[model samples]
Target: MQLFIVGLLGCSLVLSAQALYSSSDDVVELTPSNFNREVLQSDGLWLVEFYAPWCGHCKSLVPEWKKAATALKGVVKVGAVDADQHKSLGGQYDVRGFPTIKVFGANKNKPDDYQGGRTSQAIVDGALNALKALVKDRLSGKTGGSSYKQSGGGGGGGSAQDVVELTDDNFDKLVLGGDDVWMVEFFAPWCGHCKSLEPEWAAAASSVKDQTKGRVKLGAVDATVHQVLASRYGIRGFPTIKIFRKGEEPEDYQGGRSRGDIINAALDLFSDNAPPPELVEILNEESVKKTCEDSQLCVIGVLPHILDTGASGRNAYLDVMRKMADKYKKKMWGWLWAEAGAQMDLEAALGIGGFGYPAMAAINTRKMKYALMRGSFSETGIHEFLRELSVGRGSTATLGGGNMPKISSAEPWDGKDGQLPEEEEYDLSDVDLDEEFRKIEL
Candidate 1:
C-alpha cells in the first residue's frame, strides 16, 4: 500500500512538471494538430517558441515569454510548442535546439529567426519591428499574394516599370547631372547572379521611391548593351552595384543584395544627403496649409507664450521636436509649431486648447483626421505617442469642419522675450467718489 501511494504521487508530479504553462497564462499552447489552423492560417503576426520542458534555458524563458505574450496580446499573436513532445512539428521547422523563437510574418512558410534578447522588452521590440516591416511590405504591395512580373531585362520577379533601364545615352545626363542619389546596377542578361538580384533590386526601388520621396533612385544597366557606361565604372563583375552622387566619385556598393538591405543602405544615403525637415512656425493660412499638405502626416506643436517660457526654454522645446523629426525622417512627416493663443482657430480645430501648452497633434491632412498627444512632451513620451500612432493603435478624431482651419495671420516670434503692454495713467482728482456716495444715499 505504501509503494502504491508513492508511485501515484510520483506520477502526478511528473505530469504537473511536464505541463509548463496553463490557461492562466497568456501563451497559447500549440501542438502539431492545431499548429496549421492556429498559426499557419492566421493573418496576424505570430511569435512562436519551440521549447522542451526539461531544458533549463527553456524553463527560464517561460516566464518572460508569458509576459511578452500578455504585452503583445492584440498586436501580435504569441504561441508555444512543446517541440520535445511534438517532434514532428519541431523537425518540420528544423528546430534543432530548444527555445527557438520564430517570427511568422507575411510569409508563413518561411518565418524569420528571432535574434533578440531573452527579456520581455526585447521580445516586444523585436515583434514590433517585424510588424513594421510587414506593414511596409504590404504598403509596397510586395506581399499578400501580389505577384511581381518578370518582364524587365532581368529574369527576377520584379516589374520592368520599377527597375529603370539605364543606357549610355542618358546615363551621365540623368545620374551625374541630377541632384538625386542613384544606385545603379550593372548586370549582364546571361549572368545567373544578376538574374537573382533583379527581383530584390526592383522591390527595393519601389519601396525607396516612397520612403525617400524620389530623392533616391535604383536603376539597372545591361553591361553588354551599355558597355561604354559599364566600362566607365570598371564593371568587372556580372552584377556590380555602384552608388552615384553629385560631385563625388562613384563608390562600390558594399551592402547585401537583399531588398531590406538595399532599402536600409539607400535610406542611409538619403539621410546623409537630405536635410532635417524644416520646423515651420504656423503664422498664416499658407504656412499651415503648405506644411500639412506637403507630407503624409504633419506634427503640430502648440508651444507656450514667449513670455511664459523665455527664449531659452522655447528653444529647448524646439530642440526636442527637431530631434524627433530627425529620428523619424524616414517617414517624411512635416513638423510645425504655433504659439499658444496665436492660432486659436487651429487649436480649437485640433482640440489642443484643453490639453495646455507644449501639446502636440498629428494630422493626416488627406484623411481629415488627427490624433492628440496625451503623453508628456519629452522625447520618451513623444516616442511612445508616435509609436502607437505608427502601429495604428492610437485613437483619432476627424478634423473639425471637415476642412483645414482658418489660420489667423500673426507675426513670427522674435528672438527676444515678449513685452507686456504699458498701462495708461489716468487722473480722477476732482472726480466722484464722494458725489457717487451721496447720490446713492439720496
Candidate 2:
C-alpha cells in the first residue's frame, strides 16, 4: 500500500510539473510588461496566440503552434499570451475566448483574428498570408516606412544622404553582386534634369534606408566617367533611372520624376520582391474583428448556400475573389468570405441578399463605413467598383447603428472543392395520408 501511494504521488508530481513549465514551443512568451516593446514597435510581422492553461483546445493547439513558430522563426515572430493569467491584456483586445490567434501588423493597436485550421501547415500558411498583406500595404502607400515629406530642392545641394556614388570599379560589386534592391540613376554631371532631381532623390534615399532597414539602396553613376557601365545598361538619356532587382534583369523606371512618384515607385519595387497576399476564409468573430482592425479595407464575399450552388459554383466564386485579390495586391487589403446565410447579422447589416448570391462588400471598419457592389460580380465589374472606391468616388453608408455588427463562431472552410452533402431520402409505405391530413386540418 505504501509503495502504491508513493507511485501515485510521483505521477501527480509529473503532471504538475508539465502543467507549470512554460510551453517549450519556439514562440516567445508574452506579458503586459514586454508586449509593447517586443511586438508593437518591432518592424517585422507577428503572429500571437492568446490562450488559457486549463483549456483543452488551447493545450492541443500548443504543439502545432510551436511547430509553426519554429518554421517561421526569423521571417515572422510567433508569440503566445496566457490570457487566463493576464486578464487585463486579454480585455484590451477583447479576447473573450481561449486559444484566440491574432495577427499584429505594422499597427499594434489593431490585430486581425487567425481562423486557419489548427494544423501546423495551416498556421504557417496563415502567418505567411498575413505577412504578405502587411508588406503589400506598405507598398501601396497606405501605411508604413519612415515618414519623409517631399521638399523643393536640387541635386547634391546641401547635406550628403543615403544615395551612394557608384564608379565603374564599384558598379559590378555593389549593384550586381549584392542582394538588396537598388535604384541607380545614370546621369551626366551637366544634365539639367539630373541636377533638378538631386534633392528629391537624396530625400527618397534617406526614407528608403530607414523604411527598408537597409535592405534597399539608392546609387548614382556619372555616365560621362562610367562609359562601360552606361553601355552595359544601354543608357541613352543623360538622366535615366534603372531599378536593379537582385538576381533579375533590371527594369526601367517609367513613372513621373517627382519626389512622391519616386518614393512610391521604390516602395512598389520593394513590395514586388516581398511575398504576395494569401486569402483565408472567415470563420469567427475574432477573424472578423482582427481583419477590420488590421486593414484599411476588408473585402468580404457572401456566397449562396452550398446546397443551392454545389462545389462547382462555390469554387467559381472563390476563384473570382482570389483573382481580384491578386490584381489588387498592391492595395494590401484583407480578403475574407462567408456563405450568404451563415453570418445573417453580417449579411443583414451589409444588405448583401438584395443583389443575389455571391455579392461583395468593401468595408472600412475603422470608420464604420462600407460600400456595396451593385454591379455584376465578375472581374470587370468588381474592378470598376474598387477603382471608384480607390479614388474616393463610391457611395458609402454608415454601418448599422454606426458599429460593425457582431460576428459569431463559424466552421472554417476545409480548403477542399465544395461538394454538396448527399441528401437523405425517406419513404413511408403504409401511411393513412388522408386521415392524417383531415386530423391536421381539423
Candidate 3:
C-alpha cells in the first residue's frame, strides 16, 4: 500500500468513534482525523492494523484480527484500517507497502509499531503478542510503575522498526535472485542460542536499513519450519548466520553473534548491485555439467553470485561469460572453444535456477571427461582451478561440503554416485524447501 499525506486534504478534524464494540470484536473505523484520541488514549497498548483492499494477504488477516482482538481483550486493543481505503492515513505514519500490519505499543509503555505481513495469523499474533508482552511488562512495573515508561527504553531502542515476515513465495521473489548482499540466520526454536540472538539480528538489520537500505537484506530461516532449505545450504548447526556478497558468493558462521558482529558481517558484503537469480539455475549438476562440457577450451564459467539468483543476474553473469569468451578467443578456444552462461535449454531442462554466476565451472576433457573450475574465482583462482582439474594437478573433490574459496571447485567425477543417475528431474513447482515443516508445525 502506497502512502499519501492526509494533511493535504484540508479537512483534518473528524472524531467519529466507531471502534470495536465493548462486547464484540468488530472492525474499528480509525481514520487519520481520529487516530490521536482513539489510538493515543489507549489505556494500555494499541495495535493499529494497516491493510489494503486489493491485498489478498490483508483480506486473510481480517478474520484473524477479529479473533486475536477477541482473545486479547483488556490487555491491548486491536484496530485495522484499509490502507487502500485510507491512503492519506498511510502517508501520515510512513506506511509504504501492501498488506502491512503495524503494531503500536510494542516496546514497554512507549508507542511503537511493527511492519508485519505475510499470512494473517502471523501478523495478528506478532502484534497482539507484542502488546500483550508490553502489558505484562507494565503490570510487572517495567516502566516506572506507569504504562508509558519503558523498562529498557533508555537511549537504546529507536523510534524505528524492525522485523519482517517472508513467505516462501516472496522469499524467492525478493531475496534470492538479487544483486544485493544478504545475511541469513538459520535458527531453530528449541536452540537456546537462536532464541537469545533474536535482538542482535534485529539491531543489525535496523542499523543497515538506512545505509545498506536496498543494497543489503537480512533474513532468517526458522530452521524449525525450513529444514530442507537448511540442508540444501548445508546448515549444520544452530544460530548459523551466512552472508552472501554480490559477486563473492556466500560465507557462513556456525556460532552465535552479537548485533555488532552481524552488522560488521553485513558491511563486508555490501555492493551497489545485488545478485540476480537467473544465474543460479545454471549450476545445478546437469546445467553445470552441460555448461562446462559444452566448452571445449577448458571452459570457464565464473560463478560470482551468492546463494543463487532467480532471474536476470544469472543471465547477466552469463552475458559477462559470453563477452569474456568472445574477447579472449586466443586464451580460450575453437575446437578448444568456450562460450559463457547457461545454454537456455539447460536452464529450462533442470528447472534449477542458480550456480553460474560468482562461480567458475570448467571442463578439462584433455585430463578427465568432466571437471568443474571452482567457486567464484579471483583471476588467480581461475588458474588454480584449471591446474587442479588437470588430472594430476590435484585430486577432484566432491562439491557438497566445502566453503569453496576463490580457488576451489566441485567435481562430480571420480565419486561414488555411479555415472550421474540419468539426469535427475526437478520442477520448480515441486520444489518445497520447507515441506518438512508442515509435518511438525511450530
Candidate 4:
C-alpha cells in the first residue's frame, strides 16, 4: 500500500509539470522584466499566432490548433497573442482579423502563414497537409515552388527526409551553401500557431528548392536567441520575413502573405533600381495654390531642395505629413503644400524672411490664424492642430483599410466563420471623451 502511494504521488508531480508547460504554450509573454532571451536569440524555428478573444472563428479554431503543437514535438515551438487587448500592436501589424499565423527560424525574421481556408484537421496537420507545395517552394529557393517532406515529424503520411537533421545549431548549414531563396524561419516550440505553420514553411522551403533546382534558399531562425536582431529590425510583430540579397539589406515583410506575393516582392531585388517607391513630381502648382488660398489649416514643410539651409524645416513638415499620410494618402500632400506655398506671400507680407530653416506653420482657412514655429519634429508630437481638421475626434486608419467582400463569392470576408472578423464598433463617445464629459457635465 505504501509503495502504491509513492508511485501515485510521483505520477501526479510529472502530470502537474506537464500541465504547466502545456497551458503556457498558448501565448508568448513579453514584458519589460521577464523575456524569453533564450528562444529569441537561438537559431531555431518559432511560430507566432495573432488572435482576438471576441473572434468566434478564433475560439472555434483553438481545438484543432493543438494538434500542430503535438506534431512538431521536438522540432519547433508555438506562440500567440490577443490583438483586441493589444490594440497598439494590432495597428503595427495591420491585423485586420483574428488568428493570423506567422513563421520564424534561425537568422530569419517572421513570415505569414495559415492565412487561407483550411479544415480543422488540416490546420492541425499544418503546412505539411495543406501547404506542402509552399514547403517545396522554400526548398527550391523560389518564392513559388512545390513541397515534399524532408523529415522532422509533419509528414502525415508524406515522404520524409531521414538524412541531415536540421537542428537549431545546424540550421545555417541548410542555407549557407545553397543558391536557392533561403526561407529561414525564427520561431518558438511552445507556440501552437507556429507549429501549425511550420509544415507549410518547411514544405514551402523544400518544394521551392526542388522545383527551382537550387535557385533559391529557405532558412530558419529561432528568434529566442536573436532578440537583438529582431528588435533592431523592428520585429514588433511575429513571423516577419527579411528577404536578404547576396550582399544587401533584407526588407521586412509579414502578415497577409501568399507564395506568389512573397516571390514578386523579393524577385525585383535581382533587377536594377529596387528601392521603396519615391514620389518625384509635385502636383500642379496653380490649382493647389488656389485650393491652399481657399482652404483652412494649410500644413507646410520646406522643400527638399531647401536642405542646404538645413532639414529642421523640411523634416518637421515631413514628420507631420508622415503622420497625416497614414490615413489621407498622397493627394493630401498636394492640397496641403499648395496652401502652405500660398502662405509664403503672407510671410513676405509680414517680412519674416529670417524665419528658421525648418518650421511648422498652419493657417486657418476661415480664421487665417498665423501659427508658425521652429522646432524638432515628431509624427505624434503635432497631433493637436492637424487633428482639428476632423470635427472633435480623429479618424482611425484601422477602420478604413479595406472594402467589403463581394456577396457573390462563396467564401466571402464576412467577419464570420470562413470570412475574417469585422472590427467591433469602437465606442464613439469613448473615443471622444470630451464630448461624453461635456454631455454629462452640462
Candidate 5:
C-alpha cells in the first residue's frame, strides 16, 4: 500500500514538472487537443511559444513570456505549448528547438517565426508589429481567411488571375519547355472535387508566385476541354495535380488539398529545383554590379581579415552567410562578402566600417537604400535581422551618394592563412655601418 501511494506521488510530480505555465498566468496552455480551436480557427493574432519544460532557455523565458502575455491580453492571444509532452503538436509546426516562438497572424496555418528579442518588451513589440502588418494586409484586401464563398461552380475562393490557363496548344510549350517548375492541375468543369479545389489552387498560385518570384508556376487545364493533354498524362480523375520540371518526368502531387499545403509543396519543388545563391567575393566593379543587379536584395558581409580570423575562422563566417542564403533562397537575394579593408570604398558606401568587422548590410539596388545589421554575427542574430527587413519593418537609408560606389579591384581571398609582406633586405655588406653612423652624427 505504501509503495502504491509513493508511485502515485511520483506520477503527480512528473506531471506537474511537465507544465511550465499555470492558470494564474495569462498564457493559455495549449495542447494538440485544443490547438486547432484556439489558434488555427481563430481570427485574432496569436503569439505562441512551443517550449520544453526541461530546457534552461525555456525556463528563463517563463517570466518574460507571462509578462508579455499579460501585457498583450486584450489585443493579442498569447499561448504556450508544452512541446515536450505534446510531440505531435510540436512536430506539426516543425518546432525542432527547445524554445520556438511562432506568430500566428493573418494566416494561422503558416506561422512566422518570432525573430525579435526574448524580453517581455521585445515580445510585446513583436506581437504588436505583427498585428499591425496583419491589419495592413487585411486593409489592402489580402484576406487570409477561408470564408470567401464562390458564386460560380467552376471558381471558388481562389484568385483566378494568378492561375495560368493552360490549353492543349500552350501546354507543351509552357509546361514542358519552360525552365520554371510548374504545378499543373488537370481538372474537369463539371467535377465537384475540382470545384472544391479551385479556391485553394488559386490562392496557392498567388502565394507561390510572390514567394518564388515566378520561378514556380501554378497552371490549370480543363481536362474535359483538352482531351489530348489529359490523355497524354493519364488524367482519369476530376482534379489530378502533377508537378512539371524541365527535363524531368511529371510527378503526381501527393500533398493535402489546402492552400497552405499547396503553397508548401510548391515551395519545396522550387527549393529542390533551385540552386543555393552563390556567395560571391566582391573582387571588382563588375562582380559587385552584376550580383546586386541580378537580385531583389543584395546582402553584403564585411568579414574579418584572413590574418585576424585565420582560414578556419573566415570559413566559419562564410558558412553562416551560406546557410542564411540557403534559408532565404526563395527571396532570390544575392550574397557577397569581402575581407576587411579589401573593399574600403564599398564598405564606406554601405556604412559597414562603423560597425567594425563581421558586419552585414542588405541593400535594395532598385531603391538605392540599405539596412545595416546591428546584431551579433551568429545564425540567430542574422536571422532576426533579415526577418525584420523582410517584413518591411527595419530602418533603411539611401545608399551613399544616392548611387552604388565604385568597387575597387581586389584579389580574391585564397583558402590559406594570410602572410605579412616580406621586408626588403639591404645589401649592407658593401657599406660600413660605422661610417654611415658617423656621417649622420656629423
Candidate 6:
C-alpha cells in the first residue's frame, strides 16, 4: 500500500509556480556557478535540498527549510538547489525524487540522504546529529586528512588551542585558575542558538589567541552533559557567554553574535595589556625591516607633516589608525606610521606622493608585494582595504627597485599648536586698477 501511494505521487504531474524564497532568508541559494565554490570546496558541513518547483512536497518543505536555515545560520550552511532548472547538478548528485535532502558532511563527493520528519525541529535535529557524527568521525581518525590532528588520550574533541571542550572534571582548574581571562560558553546540544554560535566561537578563539598573546581564552561547556558546572554558574539558558577575569567576579557577555563583536568584547578585557600601534616619525632601516619579518602583513601610513597639518589634525588621523589596529589586533600583522616628508626615499619607493598626504599601504614583506589604499583615510575605507588583503583578494605589486629605501628618523610631534603662515598682502604700487576692479566684479 505504501509503495503504491509513493508511485502515484511520483507519477502525478502538475504545473507549479517558481519556488520563490524570501529575500531575507538565510538559506544560500545554490546554482551551478556557486555550488562548487560554496559547497564542494568548503570545509564546513552543508545540508542541501534538491527540489523541483512542480512537486507538492517540494513546495511544502520551503517553510521548514527557511526555519532550519535561520536556526543553523552560522554553525552549518543550509542550501537549496532547483533540480528542475539545473538538471546536470541534479543528475550528478543522483536525485531520484522531488524534495530530496542530502547531508554533505566532510567529504562533499559522498553525501548521505536525510531520513527524518518533515518538520522544522526534526530537520534541525537531523542536521545536528549528522554534524556530531561527522565531528566524531574526524576526531576518531576516520577522515583521510582532518583540520585537527588526532592527539592521544584527551576524551574531549577538538584542538585545545582552537576550541577548548570543557568537562566537569577540568572545569574548575581551567576556569578558576591562577591567571588569564576566559570567555566561556555554557551550551546544550539540542539548543539551536548554541549550535549557531559554535563556528563563530571557534573562529573567535583562533583569532583571539594571537591578539591577546594567549592571555585570553575561549572554552565551551556542554550544559546538559556537564550539569555540575552549569549549576555552579547558575546557567538557566543555553548559549550563555560569560567573561572570567583573573581576580574579579564573572560578568555576563551581552554583545552581538557577529565575529567582529565577539573579538571586540574580548579585546576590551585586555585594555591595559593590549599593544598599541607602532607610531614612528620615520620609516628607518630597523623599523621597516622588522615590521613584517615575523608577520603575514604590515600596514604603513604616511601622515601630513606637522608644519603642513597642525598637531590636532595629525593626532585625529592617528586616532583612526589606532582604532583600526585595535580592532584587528588578533591578526598577525604590523601597524606602523610615519610623517609625510620624514621618509622621502621610502615615500618615492612606495609612490606615496601620487596619492597625497595620509596615504597608506599594506605590504606582504615575504613576497615583496604591496597594495595601496585608493579610498578615503577613514575607518571604513581602511577596514575594507585590510580585509581584502587578509582574504588574499587584493591586488599586489613588486616593491620599487625590489628593495626598501634608506630613511632617517625625524622628531616626534612637540604637543604644541601649529601656526599657519599669514596671508600675503598685495602691493598697492604693482596693483592694476582695471584688473583688480574686473576681478572684484567677477
Off by over 4 Å in 5: 1-179, 189-214, 232-237, 246-265
Tens-place lDDT per residue, model 5, 1-442, is 9999999999999888777899999999997667766887678999999999899999899999999999999999999999888876776676888799999988665689999999999999999999999999999998664421222222222233377777788878778988989998898777877866765676678778887878898888888878999999999887899999999999999998766678888888888789899999999988978888867799999999888889999999999999999998877798999888888877888887644789999999899999999999989999999999986788999987788888888888879998989999988889999999999999
Worst 10 residues of 5 by lDDT: 148-157
Q: Each prediction's Cα lDDT score? A: 0.84, 0.77, 0.50, 0.43, 0.85, 0.76
Per model, state how many residue pairs clash.
Answer: 0, 4, 41, 92, 1, 0
Off by over 4 Å in 4: 1-39, 84-96, 105-107, 129-442
- Using TM-score as the measure, the top candidate is 1
For candidate 4, write residues 1-442 as lDDT tens digits.
9999999999997656322124545434332121134333334455556676667677665655555656654655555556666554443334666767665442222345555443544544554443454455557874321222223432112223111223444444443433434444555555554554444454444434443333444544446555655555565544555565444555554532433333333333222222222221123444334545534344554333332423454444554565554433312222233112334543343223545434444544444344443334455434454554433232222111132111111121122122245788765654778887899999
Backbone collision tally, model 3: 41
Q: Give one digit per residue, the lDDT tens place, for model 2 in 1-442.
A: 9999999999997667444225565789998767766886577899989888888888788889888989999999999888888876676566878889998886554578888899999999998998899989989875642211122122322124667777677778787898878888898877777766665576667766655556667788878978999999999996899989878999898886644566677777766775545666678877777666767789988888776777778888889888888777666688889977778888888987544888889999889999999988899989999999976789999899998787867887664556656899778668789999999999
Q: Write the per-residue lDDT of candidate 3 for residues 1-442, one digit (tens) a residue.
A: 1234564333332222122222345556576555545664444566777776666656556677777666666656677776666775564445666555555563412345565544446656676677567778778876422211111221222223333333344445445666666677777768867755654566556655654544666666666666667776787888787766545656765433645556555555453242221222332444444433433434535333222442354445556555444433322231121122324332222222354445454434444333455444444555565555432454343222222212222332221222233776777786675885775785
TM-score comparison, 3 vs 6, better candidate: 6
Could you report the Cα RMSD, in angstroms, for every candidate shown? 12.5, 22.1, 24.3, 22.8, 10.2, 14.8
The clash tally of candidate 4 reads 92
> In model 4, how large is the Cα lDDT of residue 31?
21
TM-score of each: 0.61, 0.48, 0.28, 0.30, 0.57, 0.49
lDDT for model 3, please: 0.50
- For candidate 5, report its TM-score: 0.57
Q: Give lDDT tens digits, candidate 1, residues 172-203.
A: 77788889899998988888778566556766
lDDT of 6 by residue, 1-442 (tens): 9999887776663232574464578988888767766876677899999998878898898888899999998988999999889876776566878899998886665578999987999999998998998899889988623222122222333353366677788767777864778888898878877756665576567767766766777778788888998898899997898988777888899997644567767777776455665654443667766766767788888988677778788889989998888777666478778877787777777778734889998877777788988889999999999888876678888888777667677665677666678999877997789998999999
**TM-score ranking, best first:** 1, 5, 6, 2, 4, 3
